[model samples]
Target: MQNTVSSTEAKPKKKSLKARMQKFGSFLSGMVMPNIGAFIAWGLITAIFIPGGWAPNAGLATMVKPMVTFLLPLMIGYTGGEIIAGHRGGVVGAIATMGVIVGTSTPMFIGAMIMGPLGGWLIKKWDDAVQPHIRQGFEMLVNNFAAGILGMILAILGFFIMGPIVAAASAIMGAGVNYIISVHLLPLANIFIEPAKILFLNNAINQGILTPLGLEAASHAGKSILFLLEPDPGPGLGVLLAFSIFGKGTAKASAPSAAIIHFFGGIHEIYFPYVLMKPALFLAVIAGGVTGTTVFSVMNVGLKATPSPGSIFTLLAMSPKSVSNFIGLILGVTLAAAASFIVSAIILRRDKTPDTDAASLEDATAQMSAMKSGDSSEASSENIENARDVVANYDNVKKIIFACDAGMGSSAMGASLLRDKVKKAGIDMSVTNTAINNLKDEPGLLVVTQDELADRAAQKAPNAMRIAVDNFLSSPKYDSIVLNLKARDQMDSSAAEPKPAPAAKSTPSGALDNIDFAKISEIDFLRDDDKVGTATMATSLMKDRVKKNSKAATVKSLGINDIEDDENRLVIVTPEAAKNLKTRYTNIQVFSTKDLLNSPDYDKMVSELK
Candidate 1:
């Protein structure tokens, strides 16, 4: 009892800390990420047109300093202020931001970020305190004057006070970084960075901290190694490759694809789960990070700016266009990957508990149906492993928002899948996505987020019903979401599966005559209960594609025996599954694919269904 009590108490405290950390990280990133386009524009200008740049056009180079020194910081300030208050705040934010730019000799990226939101927040506070008492018709004059006066005062204050303070802080940060390099201890920063990244602090570390420092350093040095530290995809690639080779069950199968996404697509969050599933893998990533950073430092390789997706292509684009720099960067990433792969493989192979692959990150923290009857998920924690058993009163949830750290990538894909599911189930709820920090505590809001971000989701929208999913692509929880939505609106007329568009209006291609397009309203993928995750994902992807193209066919994964023996449904299966399907049922139409998820024939196949 004592041990259980201690453990229970510890969880909330741990959750609170993580939530606070995420909140802090998200706050900083929120200021930077919205203004990334400005950063990229300046980066392109500097990269292609500066004296040391690829093109080295003196005419275009003239534009570089002005953009970086003035336009970029002002835009950042305006964006930060807009995030805090609104357009008025943005105006003041930029106003206040100008003071800092003039006050500091160095590029004042830090000062702009600080002043923007500070100006916005102060203006918002003034409005809140004074707006109710303002007379009706003269509102515009009074409001304008108030903003102007406050902004004027704030601008002066920023120039005399905040600008110098932030300049000092930026100097200290730059000195700290230089000191680390001087001691040849720069690589050790990964000891802290790697863990924070695994906790979904990648955005905070990258946008909030590294990018600002890196940009400032780049202004003087022409490039900065700080850009390479957080966005290095090498460690993640190494870990994923290890999992693909040495891991078991779903993890092994998923790692190869996850690796492609992480390395090329620059969605680094994909690898975090593999690390989370096996905590020992932290050593592998840390080792990789240290090796990569050491190689970069020794080679003196750096980029002009931070890469958005952090992909190899972006890294090269941002690289200084020198052969030696390219070699150094490639070698650093290669050796880093090699180091991580070796460490991760050894960890996987030597584990006495062979459960690393068997237990998914979701399985460790899933809390599905056990929280029914008004009990918090924590109350039913021990019993809530299976997502299918998850239940909730989604009747109160009129809108569904899939929340993630960055708000795009995984969350967008998840929203696409769930939106289709909700539409198919004839549910009327709106499904969308935004950054976790952007979530609001509005009534009828249901927030879905990855398990790692559950605490942050709660912190952002405490009143919202939060569901932690396995992943964005293929969580078993999605089916439960659909089913629960249906159950909640059982009495609604739209609760029935939607009727497919009529086939009579368009002639079928008769490519596969047996399919009988008029009779077929649905398509089925072969599903095995033990390997449900794969089938679910394939079905979702296929469904989304088919819905976009054909409009008349619904797609789902069903057991071989569960499929109806009728021409009204077309069954898609692997060649092996098709052979068994023929043995089991003669009436069902079958389309066999070497790859269900991706086939050259899929486009032609959808055309025939018309």
Candidate 2:
């Protein structure tokens, strides 16, 4: 049966909208994720250098101002530009971002994200337009001058036009947030923040908008709830905790370790795939967010600065030196976790089959032990759309890429794991990791991304086969992919080896009988009238299949006249065309197309021109 939907069937518009949102989320995450190291460094500096901090030297404290003002924003711009183009783009991006940074005391992280990519894209367009017209000898001269002039213009534009406007916008946004906090309506902000964070826009919300406001508030009051709003681990903790208890099979076993890493280690990205695996669990996160924020607001507890990775320890380390603030923070996390776990557990319980027997706890434990021992294999029937159609031409794949939120983290690790697998399998294939934003459409490519980012990956690499996984670090799908590639390689090798043709007879009194069959390297498909391209299309199809199956056959299409009298060539012709070829060139090898196409030893027939 064909795997397809009817042409008249309309795809759900809601899904399309969600996909667009996810793509935008991916773009925003890309701009911020790369600068995470800088955020961590700055977080550490702010924690130690403030007036009441452990190392509160007035001179050392002053460094924090310039660090956020210049260094962080410039790093963002450079990373954004590198994503769009390369090193040149990064240089121009940093230069352009300096203008925005100088124009205001507020951090220009969002503005830099915009200007950096814009600068790189403009230069890319210019290079695309000019490179074709440049003389070979003068190419180097033109390239350097063009980039320099373009960078200067962008820097000036950033200073004169973009800088002030973005500053005004940032001020207005900050004021709005302050008003919300002043009126004690700040907890309502979680309505928007929780959803955006789940969509992978956590960094954008935390660093781009909330951080600026929190910085101002902390400067005045020594703490602000804005710092805690986006970075709170309560919601993620709640979801993972619920999964640990209520989730089935591997999900139940894995959620405990994920919880520890998420709460303690502070890499919140680990839990994203868990929520994405069941989007309905979004409600649990939202509920958790609202509950935690409400607690924080009621208790009037806030952090001194934004926590970089949102770890519980870091959040505590950055908290104001007060007992009530500490209690409130702990209470908020506990209540949110309780709320989210309650809701998620209910959802999971409802999803379970009423008639199906639950796995025994002992059996579940043993299964997990087996998985840890490397005895587990990926089940083929995992949930994915158009799985067969996606890999319909699996043999054509020459490249495979893994894409993730931060190109450096999970995607890079996944690519490395798969590369090791391919190396051990002795396959000649290229496997690598790239940011989803940096990917472009190419033939003969396969892209693997987490389920949440799969839509964005498809849009970026439209021609490539795409496989979506619930988790990059531990997916069973890779096993199936490896098996498929190995099978294709084996089939191709077997098909390429030469085989004896069926028509063995005593030598006849003809020039063709003396011709050596072993010398033939090229095979031609002779056609009569291809005026309508019927023969051309057929020849292309035949050639592709033959090439995939054979190692040495240089297949080609030819009109009778185009057939060369080379000793190393053999031709397949239709029944009518064979009469003319056989009469005119008795020394040249020829076979009927019907005979070759119908032959049982297809690989042997291809090799021997049967």
Off by over 4 Å in 2: 1-15, 199-224, 247-250, 267-280, 298-308, 317-327, 346-400, 408-432, 440-445, 485-610
What lDDT would each prediction earn against the true structure? Answer: 0.77, 0.68
For candidate 2, list the clashing residue pairs, or say none: none
Give the CA lDDT, 0 to 100, for residue 256 in model 2: 96
Q: Work out the TM-score per prediction.
A: 0.76, 0.66
Q: Distance (Å) between predicted and true CA of 262, model 2?
A: 3.1
Scored against the true structure, residue 20 in model 1 reaches a CA lDDT of 80
Poorest lDDT segment (10 consecutive residues) of candidate 2: 1-10
lDDT of 2: 0.68
Model 1: per-residue Cα lDDT over 23-54, one tens digit each:
87887888788777778778888889877678
The digit string of per-residue lDDT tens for model 2 on 335-367 reads 888888888888888885442222654333333
